[model samples]
Target: PRSEVGDLIVIFRAGAYGASASPQSFLGHPPPIELTIDGDEIL
Candidate 1:
């Protein structure tokens, strides 16, 4: 498989118990966490 390299967007609630939509990217691969607020992605 081609090595997945590049940016990614992860969505979840501000709460600690919210499950991440992109768990594979957020919890796996050691990706950096970027927060999204009010349907807007953090630049």
Candidate 2:
């Protein structure tokens, strides 16, 4: 995958730990969306 080294990628389940540990703000990334569920709603 060397040809795709700089392409955008999605790292599944990174939020479990990476989000908290990664210096996203310092890296200039916006805050990640948080999800919450209650009954039949997703907030």
Candidate 3:
């Protein structure tokens, strides 16, 4: 565990409790980035 302590990882599809799911703007949250990973057209 010490060897991987500095590494940064992202967990996707973990649950529906994500901020971008719903009621985000009402709580003064910024808009999340929408990614379109179509081949090299990753936007």
Best by lDDT: 2
Q: What is the C-alpha RMSD of each candidate to the true structure, in Å?
A: 7.2, 6.4, 5.8
Q: On residues 1-43, what C-alpha lDDT tens digit does candidate 2 reach at each position?
A: 5547556544556556645576678668786654444567985
Poorly placed runs, candidate 2 (over 4 Å)? 1-26
Judging by TM-score, tell me the better candidate of 1 and 3.
3
Measured on C-alpha atoms, candidate 1 has an lDDT of: 0.53
Q: Per-residue lDDT for 1-43 in model 3, tens only?
A: 4548556445555466554576767668776554434567875
Q: Between which residue pairs do clashes occur in model 3?
A: none
Task: Report the lDDT tens digits of candidate 1 across residue range 1-43.
Answer: 4446674545455565444444555546764555546645553
Can you tell me which runs of candidate 3 are displaced by over 4 Å? 1-24
Window of ten residues with lowest summed lDDT in model 3: 31-40
Q: Please report, as a residue range, the 10-residue window in candidate 2 with the lowest summed lDDT.
A: 1-10
- Considering TM-score, which of the candidate structures 2 and 3 is the better prediction for this target? 3
